[model samples]
Target: MVLEGVYKVRSIDEVVELLEKYRENAKIIAGGTDIVIALRNEKITPKVLIDISSIDELKSIKDEGEFIKIGAGVTFTKIVESSLFQKNLWGLYKACRLVGSPQIRNKGTIGGNIANGSSAADSIPPLICLGSTITLASKNGKRKVLLEEYYKDKANYGMKEDELLVSIDFKKPTENRVLSFAKLGLRKALAISRISIATFLELDKKGQVTTIRVASGSLGKYPMRELEVEEFLCGKKLNERTIDEAIKVVQQSMDERLKGRSTLPYKRVAVESMLRESIGDGIKFLDGVRA
Candidate 1:
């Protein structure tokens, strides 16, 4: 792959400035895990490359009262090392831990993963279950969008040409809430996910589900919230019966969405176990917390 120019930007402002100048002719590179592959395959040909890997302001993780904010430049290794995620956000931690090999985790940025917008992206399903929002910045100002709505199509995310994604924010989960993730891949290590599920569940004192959010990856054109499963789980008790019913709802939806695909039969069966395991993990996490 060849580029006319490369700019190592140190701040978000510099990145936005370069984007404004180069517009569609420019592409942003952080970890380069995805972009490098795309460049090699000639899938993308950019006249200029704006590298935001060294931007200091985009690498910090902070607690902002009601929400926890993660800078876009923070790497998967950074996330796996954070006590905050290990202690509270285990779903996200687990996802990051399984992103790729150690070398890939060290180089891949969360921002890059989200920006790449692959259906198999590891971080997105969990982020969506957590009700995450992302901030897009440009010379004009910054705008926030729900992560679940960011993808307008399978191939295109809603980011503007002049906007750089700066940070992702999600409301801090309370003691009553639990989040969990499960994935099916071809192999145990460094395997691309074939299917995955993330579940966010809130339980009441009597052990009934008060609220529930279910999101999945590699199950559709893009990572998406499983609204039917969520609706069925809400206000219900997390028992074997409820879990079985939820699995059927998910299978029905998947069948309708991926009816003619070659992977449909396998995915339809695999997703049930993934969803079951994710929901079970969420319940177990909450149980351990209460204990």
Candidate 2:
């Protein structure tokens, strides 16, 4: 059985003070989705839970000069419903949609998702694909880290004990860019992804791939960008043959990294399928057609 701890804090300052004073014994709880599950499973037992859900400063979505800054405390549902996100960040909106049930999405925060650092986390795959970065804050100050480099270990994120994820920065996609998020789960909604893929490609006026990024989750120890595949796809035409080759390269690279894992075959197939679909959709988007 799980033992519940006394939950405290209603503001960002309160949270920072708690973390500063009890960094070793306190844990931050945003949505409580991941932590509740862990508590139920006896995976973690904290003496104090600092709830940051009511932090007003950390609950907003704003447009910066070059990027859209999404407050870490914003919910998945908020992300999906935001007009700014729908108009400017279709991939991220779609990733938020893929999270879980409506209630789960309403409760889950991007900070919690990134802080958990699970390879299967829905938004992480797409964020990595978009070259996203996360800002972490503490009583001392703050620092920014690329989402791709945030995963410090297999079981946990690289965040320091006193730091809290404050926001995510989404750089404006280049003109004629195509971005997409896809995932394979056993059941439709509320299921953990067996494999997930995110694709972002920028095409020039002549239809050549100018820039491309591909990221996959649940295919390795950490959600990662398939840079080899991206490099191969650059300057290539978005054709069946080229797409197949790119998928093959990704599969081969994943195979080398995931040698003895039991889910290799399934993940390989899913990755290929998702990549092809993403590429096709991205190409259509670049061509100014519906995908």
Structural similarity to truth (TM-score) of each candidate: 0.96, 0.93
Query: What's model 1's TM-score?
Result: 0.96
In the range 1-291, model 2's lDDT, one tens digit per residue, is 223565556666677788888776778889999998887776777767888888888889997867888889999999898886563257678888888899999999998988887888888887888788888888988788888888745235478888888999978775566678777888897887778888888877767888888888788777888889989989987788998899899999989998998888888888888888767767766677422
Superposed by TM-score, candidate 1 places the C-alpha of residue 100 at a distance from the truth, in angstroms, of 0.8
Best by TM-score: 1
Per-model RMSD to reference: 1.6, 2.4
lDDT of each: 0.90, 0.81
Error of 2 at 255 (Å): 0.7
Q: Number of clashes in every candidate structure?
A: 0, 0
**Per-residue lDDT of candidate 1, residues 21-121 (tens digit):** 99999999999999999999999999999999989999999988888999999999999999888655899999999888999999999999998889999
Which candidate tops lDDT?
1
